[model samples]
Target: MRYDIPIWKKSNLTLDEAAAYTGVGVCKLREMSNDEDCEFVLWIGSKRLLKRKKLDEYIEDMYSI
Candidate 1:
């Protein structure tokens, strides 16, 4: 079976917003970022930002059923 993944185009999101969108606890998301497991996270001027495109890609790559 094949599945089509939706493409997201938003450039960035706050950590809290990403957590809410992904339904993952903020603490866990932070841990993932710290461990370098957050493929969607980027550092912008010392602030961490999440790319909506990357987050959607991560979900497609890791959670798509």
Candidate 2:
């Protein structure tokens, strides 16, 4: 079963949207964002957003490892 969130439909996704799209926890994504190597997070003022393309690339890299 697929859960299609409206925010996930966008190119830029918030932390929650990225979590839903990746089947990963929001906390994990936040943790990744804290890593110096993870440059996929976008900061707009105090809000954080993740690029859907970057998240997809991250998932692909994880599985390819």
Candidate 3:
């Protein structure tokens, strides 16, 4: 069966989904994910995903992007 999970409920998010959820923009999200100090980036081969909970925490802790 296929799951119909929402972006907010997901464990990880694509750049587009994250952009929509966080209002951070896809290019910016990609840039942020490329940072070595970033804690929420997950790589599956050439694809990058963001851990949603960690992203939320990161954003919450940050004063600015």
| Segments of candidate 3 deviating more than 4 angstroms | none
Quantify all predictions' global Cα lDDT against the true fold.
0.71, 0.79, 0.94
Question: What RMSD does model 1 have?
Answer: 9.4
For candidate 2, report its TM-score. 0.74
Ranking by TM-score: 3, 2, 1
Per-residue lDDT of 26 in model 1: 78
Instruction: Write one digit per residue (lDDT tens) for candidate 2, span 1-65.
Output: 98775764788888877887888898888988876566687888878888888878888878542
* Candidate with maximal lDDT: 3
The digit string of per-residue lDDT tens for model 3 on 1-65 reads 99999998999999999999999999989989998888999999998999999999999999999
Q: Which candidate gets the maximum TM-score versus the true structure?
A: 3
Better of 1 and 3 by TM-score: 3
Off by over 4 Å in 2: 1-8, 63-65
TM-scores for every predicted model: 0.64, 0.74, 0.92
| Ten residues in sequence with the least summed lDDT for candidate 2 | 56-65
